[model samples]
Target: MRSERRHVLVTGASGTLGAEICRRVAGTGWDVTLVVRTRDARAAETARECQELGAQTTVVAADLADPGSAEFVVEHARATIPTPMAGLVHCAAHFTFARVGRLADDLHSDYLRSFDVNTHALLRLIDQCGRHMVDDGRIVALSSVNSVLGLPGSGAYAASKAAAEALIRTASRELGHRGITCNTVQLGLVDTPAAAAVTDAGVRDLYAMQSAVGRTGRAEDVAAQVSYLLSEQAGWMTGQTVRLDGGFQCR
Candidate 1:
């Protein structure tokens, strides 16, 4: 039997990875609510793409860093969606490169900003979704391989992502009784606009060499994994961090 189409909420809908996830999920015939931080040209383009795929789409501008934003987003989504949301893919994250020395003064705000969006916002969204979603809802959050790899100059970002994963694990246990699954996907070097902006040819080559696939990952690669995790086939999986690093963590 064909599965009935469902509604999904995707954060960071304007970025490369998030936009691809929105497109991929919509292509699967699911209604999509894009929780973008800003209603930019990119968000509009992504929404247009999803609509073209025949999936109903709604774009909500929200900054996850703000304490009240999650509640507002939940209320907006509940009003806009024709049915209960079945899935939430949190792809929004704040990252700024800095060393341990920067943790003391003005740069302290950097850590706070990262944690506010990467960890606390995720918790707030999941809590709201838990109260409203139908049984068997799926929740997926985007993490980075740096969370575990202990990469230098990534202390704050890694700490925030690691904390997010810890929260997801606990959430899975708590929501399991309701048939909801929470999981995190850890990504490595992906060929996204963000990476392109920071990575030079030498750095890209280094990352490619470390991957078993001998090439960098694409945004679509991460999107495919998220799409699977949101499907009924992944109902039995929860409280786990799935890695899409092309074996970079193994090396």
Candidate 2:
């Protein structure tokens, strides 16, 4: 007896990590939806890649940081994507640097933006996804290792991400009975557009040196772990944050 293919929605799909995840799921014959906050010039290539892998895709515009964006994401998923939604990969997040005390003025708005996209929007997406998602669905949100590691300049960002991890655990407990499993992968430093802006060469080298594997994390590496968790093999796993940090947090 085999299960049917699932519809998987991936946020931040225009980027390196999210795009790779979309490709992975689509290769498995699942219908994929890419929730893009803004149009990417490479979107057509991405769509072609997914389509070639035997998955249908629909791209929708959504800024998860916006208050009502979750509803809009869901609406677009329902109206535009061919579904029977089974999984969601929440790869969207907002990050900003603040010393927690020195940058007082940036606190309120930064906190709201962080929570809006990283925490609140995730909860909202899960809730809205419930209506269209299958009973045995899976949800995977991308989190940074900083959620627990306490990076010096990213205190608020860390807290906001921690909040998301907490919610994933709680949601897993409540939704487990419905055959739904919620999990978040706390990734270590990865070289994405987010990291590309870091001007500190020494810090960058330090991160690379810290990984047990002696290399910075890759977007695809994190995405691969997330893909497995979304598969039937991970059905027994829920209510936890899996560390995907290449042993950076091991110290």
Candidate 3:
């Protein structure tokens, strides 16, 4: 119902959850700047989809792993948008599966990379965005249920996600004076192309059964929660990590 053409920047905009968030926010008349790691076909496709949904989309290709990419994105975002960034969603993530002490070759680097993108990169982006955020700004990061549960193969991943949530909590307190709210969404298994590539079918089935809803989550489900957090209705909600696991961990 709102059609103000407010601006939002979404990292990992080419991925499944990211794309869904783009479409949903754009539908509500928000202009979106997609921060992508690569300017690939999928990135173009996502941009096209957001355009069709009536949101102006600008794709800036930069790897979040690079230390300066956050500044680069913020520069492009400032130049391209109509207003200061009103919302930000950090959905980009890097994950590698390996049990402790059974790591693959170069696994240490992989663990470092996971934290770089999932936690440190988010911190960088938040710092830049916070400096230029308009009043009532909303910031949301995509987190994982692994942060809370003792999942067998997710040690590094869990640690990185937990770190991101800590940053979000502190950020909410720091930025509240600017009327900005910061939060994270801790997600469960979602049926997406990215998840499909890494998920073992047997493990997937086990997770699906763990849900009170008796199903895995969808990208749309994650996007819907994010959209609400960005809306004016959620002004009072901040510093919280909302879990969207279909009650999977409730058992």
Global local distance difference test of model 3: 0.90
For residues 168-236, what per-residue lDDT tens digits would candidate 1 score against the true structure? Answer: 999999999989999999999999888787678898888888888898999889999999999888999
| Clashing residue pairs, backbone N/CA/C < 3 A, model 1 | none
The local lDDT score (0 to 100) that residue 211 gets in candidate 2 is 77
Error of 1 at 26 (Å): 0.2
lDDT (C-alpha, whole model) for all candidates: 0.90, 0.83, 0.90
User: Which portions of model 3 miss their true places by more than 4 Å?
Assistant: 1-3, 102-107
| TM-scores, one per candidate | 0.96, 0.93, 0.95
lDDT of 2 at 56: 82
Candidate 1 weakest ten by summed lDDT: 1-10
> In model 2, which residue pairs have backbone atoms overlapping below 3 Å?
none
**Model 2, stretches more than 4 Å misplaced?**
1-3
Tens-digit lDDT track of model 2 for 16-59: 88888888888875888888888777666787799999888888
Q: What lDDT does candidate 1 reach at residue 141?
A: 99
Report the lDDT of model 3 for residue 172.
Answer: 97
Give the per-residue lDDT digits (tens) of candidate 3, residues 1-251: 45467889999998989988999998987889999988989888888988899878799999999999999999898898776579899999999887877555466887889899999999999999888888889999999988998478888788899999999999999999988999999999999988888888887898888888888999999999999999989999999999999989543
Q: How far is candidate 2 from the true structure (C-alpha RMSD, Å)?
A: 1.9
Q: After superposition, how far is residue 167 of candidate 1 from its true place, in Å?
A: 0.6
